[model samples]
Target chain A: MPKESDDLSTLGELGESAVLGRIFPRLPAASAQLLGPGDDAAVVAAADGRFVVTTDLMVHGPDFRLAWSLPHDLGWKAAASNLSDVAAMGAVPTALVVAIAAPADSPISLLEGIADGFRDACGALAPGCGIVGGDLSVSDTLTIAVTAFGDLAGRPPVLRSGARPGDVVAVSGALGEAAAGLRVLFAEALDANGAPDAVLASLVRDRTTAQLTPSPPIADGPLAASAGATSMVDLSDGLAIDASRVARASGVRIDFDRGALGADPDLALGGGEDHSLLATFPPGARLPGGFRPIGTVVAPADDEGNVSVILLDGKPYTVSGWDPYTGWKDSGVAGGSAG
Target chain B: MPKESDDLSTLGELGESAVLGRIFPRLPAASAQLLGPGDDAAVVAAADGRFVVTTDLMVHGPDFRLAWSLPHDLGWKAAASNLSDVAAMGAVPTALVVAIAAPADSPISLLEGIADGFRDACGALAPGCGIVGGDLSVSDTLTIAVTAFGDLAGRPPVLRSGARPGDVVAVSGALGEAAAGLRVLFAEALDANGAPDAVLASLVRDRTTAQLTPSPPIADGPLAASAGATSMVDLSDGLAIDASRVARASGVRIDFDRGALGADPDLALGGGEDHSLLATFPPGARLPGGFRPIGTVVAPADDEGNVSVILLDGKPYTVSGWDPYTGWKDSGVAGGSAG
Candidate 1:
């Protein structure tokens, strides 16, 4: 009899179906998981009578690179991306379903590594939130699609539209590390065959770690909700971009004090993939620990309903954060420092 | 202002964020879609106070190839795989969230074609169902990941563990078309420059069509549930293999009558990817239209507790079905009269 490893090549060798067989057996049985991995779909008991759902897809080049990131890191990133959406809504993630597409030649170990990453991330983010179900198919590239479900605990879901003028702006969790980490990875890859400075290398590695696995402050989302947060959004597409969304929805302008932003300006404004909660609170509201005041909201400009960022000196900053259409260039200094 | 066509490039050129921006505006608004696209997560209403969920991934090479399949077909297959799972649970598909990963150099039109495929498939299979949200990223290859949600409509979910001895076996749709289609696609790709026979060529074309865009018969799943199916599953991995699963779960033997299993033997027992519902009903129970009787359940044999396949003429046919570890050739031709 062939050993299991011999019987099953890496996910790439056995293809999608074989990989699924390996994964299905290891999952925990849940009452909510009326149907598990094998069938067309898995049925879960949607407690609170409603389910909060979100999805994110991670691709190889733009989202990750097998050469630079481990399978586990990919898994962690995939789970965090979806779970953060649940957190942004002030809901507790309960379950997740993943859809992974990889080349037929991908190794089984890599698939397992990705699964392990998912398990580790889930364990850290939401205990018991295991992968209830997913589908695997061969594709030209490696892609992960994840959908996360959460329970609101019957509380009204927090949305981006709830902010009002005079609401205090706040954020939870660090920003800019992931973006900075990505920069380092690219630079390192470009200068292959030569070693960089030890300290610089470590700094780059730390940033990449942030890029690969983001820890969304789930607790802070619920904390803000309980404290009567007026509006909430996750800092995924940079603080300025996401905050602009909140401002547009709430019909307000958000003014930022560069001094109040964390030690990193880039981390606060243009940094992305942070998965932090950027929220608003009414004046004099007592914020939970880790929740720090960053800015204030005011009426939107008469010509535009969208949010505009104002500096402490009351001038609009020329930088518009990260825009996918317009590429990001190193602006002389790292963004984490005060402007 | 460049024309959309001139401006468009492969998904890779636009990058992850740009692709997202292009696709996000095309989606329709649904009350159930609390948050649509562009966030860490999307919020959907699971109105039945419960949510039925399932996911599937489509990869390149193994699941699909760019040479024979269009981007639209890939999209269709991705959505179909997940929606079929929802149908297997006797649930009505309501919404879908997709995550896509493709090479950075992939054309935006191809991505749009993939989205169009989702839109078209959803429109045809479940009209009210919508592609509520998604994420796009770049990878070394093209991969599609989809998660589908369904409503139970107050009916108890049909599971795979409810089959009993003396239960009748039935299926609701055509089988073997997808496997047949795959064979054609490979054969054509292998002989890309050669001219094949007209009839064979047409069949191959049809087969590729079937494989590229599987039309999962979702309605039958719910019909079986309403008609009191004792046990049920989708024919994703061939009948003999899937039947064995039901037998093991229900502690019974599933004896398939070759005569009653449609007109094609290859389709009846060995073909996979049909996405047809195979269900068990009480003996002499009324079955929904299109559900043809194919087998019967019997008491388990020996102490192994494994489901055994009893063939016509008192012969015991060892289970032969599609297994990734061992390719599908033997299973595809086993227990069948070669034309």
Candidate 2:
């Protein structure tokens, strides 16, 4: 829990306007915003006459536990996750509209910290991209829902279905670090009875930071698009699963060279939440900076049913990605709180 | 609880992909969509080089009760609420990106009904505006967060601060009906102990329907803009409070003729969630067909503090708007479930 301060008030004490007043100043201003908060809606410049949009939700129980994530980390992760989606469309993020629902007793400092995180994340990851507007509600669960918008800059969107048989699959940003971080957190968080212990903090800071606040290569998306990437996807649900998505969409099979994947290839293949850019470039084409060759697209086998096929060193890789519902039950976290 | 059927499997039974497969077919197609769902993000056309964006959250406890709100009603109300913000900007809604977080055991039919609600709401309220993309997550509380986008269509956005002294205050769509409906629902929902029984339906079907499924005059917004509305606001809050917002924003005091507010002016002044469009037109300007004049804006009084001033037939109207945090406690509706 956040340290209680006499200066800090709770949402229950300070009404919506007062809470927003405290947060708005901490947020970064959007370059594309024509109108910001305090209105019914915000107007953003979609300079290219088309904009890419996506939304993602981070809920308290399933997505993150307050014990594991600070308010700042929650905001950073939420913004980074949604921003990665906008980048995956091969678009430069322009603005974000965030909606948060938290318990009435949540401190004003929590929201202020969230706003600061949004400011810093946008400043670091995608300069000029900032929060345009937001809404707040009182709820039992702390839910953060963000919708990000991006400007394509007149380039055609690079889609998952556009890959061909001979394309080389490349990935930008770290693959397995985030999942490794999650493991570190879980191991440290669990008590003797295997239930989560809220008091514990992960000793592995780097891996924990990667899991908590990932910095996806936002610029690499448009760079790959400019370099004529045939297909692209954000590595949100592990390399193997996301690669299969591209392969299935493109009617091909992906074969990964185990050596090409960094030192822990198994973790790279099965771990999730890296938010890396995975793009397929034509053979012999110049790979964009930050992207490393990971796999190759091949024709689907005739006898095998038309299903997602992923191969690791010429053998079928059967490991799957994260699924929230099943994962929640499988993890045995039990409830919303450790207490 | 929704009726159980052999075909209606729960979300836990069918993973995200299968659940999405069921919902995708039921959602309406967006005319402004360049690329739709199933991608990392959706691309939407912003023909005039700008788009209006807004987000809202509807959570289970403070926002609605599942006992009273059917899945379809939840979906319809959520869409209508967000769409009204887009309309309030004097823009035509083009697309929505929705993110929903529900318990793992939630029925797939609940999602299907929500999808159907989105389809029907878009069909009736804002034709051609549909769900372009969405995300799903598992949570203890069922939360629906919607971000709506609208095309400006080459018109200057009508802002809340644009109203000038001598402007005629006008409104389109009925006020207080939704709040009245809430009152009806509360009366019927409470048992002998004054706790929510969650069994009885409101006797006043029209009022309950009004509260559950509102049809705000969306088209009148642009019409009012075309007829030269100086300022505009969506009346999700009570008329007195929303008018106060306009009064405060424009640095003007609004004097409303109580008789102009249909029967039960007190209800009109204090009730909320009607989602009506409240606009100001310059004196002698032609009021749009559906808009009825309710009040007039005047210069701020020299003696009164520089705060929101709203007069109901010359006396100060002290009733405040809804604050979710305070209202959640004030209503005495404890816990997520009635049980």
Candidate 3:
């Protein structure tokens, strides 16, 4: 465990070279990375004549709050957001490169904490995964830009537009926990008192910890693909929006049985930032391990002529989560206000 | 031309999806990209068993300025910076992914201009190299995070630690132009007038244009490797500092002859952001195309025992450029001011 000692040492005080030296050794070595950091660029093992690539940016104010999230949590969240996209593509996560810009006076401990989180998350979440290379710069607001690369291993990528009518929509992990956690965190933050009482904190479920340290089922992506999943997406945004995306792409309607989600059905529909995989499998197809059926894809209804892309319990789902553009500046972070 | 008629259509006014729609069509398509943007992740072709990967972040205020640099220039410069590293690794540039976050009030035209610049740069400098996928978010500052991937063909990667005693040191492209350009840009920015006279602008050579839009000799890295080049590095910093890094890695010294270089020898040695390739080849080895001898690698000196990794005119060279640790705020951009 990195000592949570709040040292005042700043990255500027420790030169760029020295700061790199401090974090490089902490990174785990991966067999998939042919050449690691310190080179002009890193060399990662590829497969199937093609590779899957994706990138995401996490800014300090909009994506996260430094007050509630530790440097370690921020690092884990950044990796989780990007890695989940790779998993959503039905590929096995292989390598990641991060470019971070931070205020000059920021603590060196922030970087050290982030590095620890990066190593630990990869080790626990996707065992052979590792960060290959990265760049560090100086800026007023903290920003982390991560690009994750994955190997398809001879499988065709499961795209959002592949779902057909009668396909069963399933999920590889629990949903709405992140949004719940965000709500709780924000409520406590607004209280002006420190974190809530220990009793209340203990009541928060472990799965809800996704808001801080998401552990998406990355391996399940390839499993789902091999099992013949027709389409897929990462539930980074709320279910209503993400499912609507697939509905629009595939020209269908996603009907979700909210009551079947157990309690707090709105969490499954309106909550966001869970980073779980939402996929559709053909009827009678072998279901992948770690996946549970949540909904179904059907032909659009023509009764009203203007059909809704997503529905809840057979009716149009009116609520939505996290629309960055429509939301005001003072609104909540990336996932927006939770259900 | 991207219709420079900026109507000031803010990103907020256009909405997120609309902004993406505007830029997506403007991006050039590439054969190397098996699955392009609009997907959860992009699939890039990498014939070799391994691929080279790297990332960089360009932040506004410190890395760039809205007052001087247009959005198109920012996009081109971001692409150039990361792609140059790919070339420095002796690999053919293949694909790029960019994640940009900006203030809500920023104009949609900025993104369009950036996309145009990205397409033009890849088309001109490296055909088949184009952005494959990306993410966007809202933030107070404008930031562009670029991650580039490349194929190494069948050649081995040339590392900085491979230089041996008596190796012939050479440069694949011009040096010092970027630093000179930065100096000129800063001087012009400080002028009471927006820009200087046409004569003064012409006096700023084409090489200085590199500071804003660097065009490094990326193809030279692999050529040098195939030609039996022993060691190599990218001169994103000054030649002297970059040479020092090579010498430190190889445990040797590099001697630069001032007389061999034309007038303004300091530009060749002390200027930074050139993005040129500095490499050492075996003595009497056939030099590759686009390379010219600049210095020689030699044994570590033991007479006085005071070591300098890089030497000029057979004497220890002392001048340096862009030491982030030593500089204060209000210095040049591009990792300029830090500790």
Candidate 4:
């Protein structure tokens, strides 16, 4: 076997079992978890007698890079991505299964770091959400896939299709922080030597932390469901795009107040991976705490089978949100246009 | 952006969404599935109101390779690995989520093939179990991570630690086929130019198929459970190793009839990835069809917690099973003594 020092930067630094050991200790115990890591499978309690499931994968390079993230960051990000999906449905995350592929020659410390990352995210974001079980295999590159399970606690799940035309649009948590963080990380002017130490540290911290590991507003999701939110989604593909999904699913148009969105419009409209809860409520329904009103669901315009995002002044925004199929580029925002 | 002929053989050849599209259609539709693939996450109906979850990762090189297997095989293997865990619990598979990492230069056709592999495996073994959601990203090598969910149908789950002395040891399905197949694939003699077409085809087929895609006996697992088997496990790490686990957990020593292990003893004892079901039953319990009596559970002779597997004439076979931490060669029959 190669010495850890020889490839400490790679995932081979830590062995799979050792990596799991590091993360397992940090996880909180959940009542719903019948079995946690170290078994063939995890047994979780389904209080409502139904389980909610979601999965997401993170690959080194396209999704992330070693130069931009630490192993722990990657782990945290992997867990958060799936956990957020569970949260999107107003479900309580119960357990997570992680499968990681890395090169044999990669340092084992990288795997340890990745496990730590996953544990850290699950620890803080969804306490008691243990790493139930997973598989490890050697690969040419680093890849982490996480599957998360959640419980509905016997309540009907709040889906994106539940929003009605008269529903009030609202959001929990700030938008664009992750996107802004990414921007600062990629900004040429913020290089280590050129930028102020404090500013650079803060920027790097936010950028690397948020970009590498997202913090999903899981707590607010169940609260929204309790507050009778009509429809909801986790803002992964920017607000405009995801909100459009809700609008189209509910057969309604959504109108957003530019003032309510953060100072950066791109963060609200074009930013991806924030994982904030975007929800809608009946006009008179009780709203959850920390939820800020952002927009309103409205009747569709002349376009058939389409959901458009109108601006504060009742004009449509010409620029659509991010599309994975189409390359991303800067575009001027316009009023009264369909996305 | 690269053409198919550009030699990029990486994951980029298959776009992430496109890969999902191929596998989504081939899965069996389960009534427990509230939503199938093509969404942010799949919602599965947990019949007992709970779920059994597990995950496994397949990485190129350590787990598989392009030279030895095709992309489709990797997909099937990844899904099967996790599905085996769910089966180990005597649960019915409900849904699956996959995370794939590949190089950008890979041909899209390879991704489609991988998806097809997943579909094929699910169709044959886990009908109604589909890849409901997944993430795709570029990496240096091909990595597949699959998370599987299962429903228990309200039966008390059979755990590994429930065995007792005097319990009859039995197995469902074939043993050692995968390990034997692997050996055939690696043997130099089999690669000779003038090898018989039928024999060579069977050998190659067994080796290639077993190595690339292991079919876990999911059906037989629940069957054993319904038959009142005391303790059960999936033959993932090999019979001796996994049986020892049952012995240790149940606080009993297990003795096996070497002659009854089938035509090949090595295949039965130390073969890994056969994905057969091993269970312990009461002495007078009626054994289910397809279940072959192999041994008897007895009290541990020593305090070391070592479970002995004796021969038919009462001779001790000291060889243990495979351990991931240890090299595969050391755990084989030829290299080590049976315990």
| TM-score for each predicted model, relative to the true structure | 0.86, 0.95, 0.92, 0.85
i-RMS, every candidate? Answer: 3.4, 0.8, 1.7, 3.3
lDDT of 1 by residue, A203-236 (tens): 4555567777788877677778788888888888
Worst 10 residues of 4 chain A by lDDT: A327-336
Candidate 3 residue B156 C-alpha distance from true site, Å: 0.9
Which lDDT tens digits does candidate 2 get at residues B277-308?
A: 99999999989868999999888988766444
Candidate 1 TM-score, true structure as reference:
0.86
Deviation from native of the Cα of residue A116 in model 4, angstroms: 3.9
Rank the candidate models, highest lDDT first: 2, 3, 1, 4
- Between candidates 3 and 4, the one scoring higher on TM-score is 3
Give the proportion of true interface contacts each model preserves, from 0 to 1.
0.69, 0.88, 0.71, 0.65
- How does residue A196 of candidate 1 score in lDDT? 32
- Consecutive 10-residue window with the lowest summed lDDT within model 4 chain B: B1-10
- Per-residue lDDT tens digits of candidate 4, residues A159-189? 8788887788999865766766666665632
- Candidate 1 steric clashes: 38
- Sorted on DockQ, best first, the list reads 2, 3, 1, 4
Question: Model 2: runs farther than 4 Å from truth?
Answer: A1-6, A193-195, A304-308, A331-339, B1-6, B193-198, B202-204, B304-308, B331-339
The TM-score measured for candidate 4 stands at 0.85
Please list the residue runs of candidate 1 whose C-alpha ends up more than 4 Å from where it truly belongs after superposition. Answer: A1-9, A12-35, A103-108, A183-208, A305-313, A320-339, B1-35, B38-40, B188-209, B303-307, B310-314, B323-339
TM-score of chain B of each: 0.86, 0.93, 0.89, 0.84
How high is the lDDT of residue A220 in model 3?
89
Q: What is candidate 4's CAPRI-style docking category based on DockQ?
A: acceptable
Clashes of 3: 0
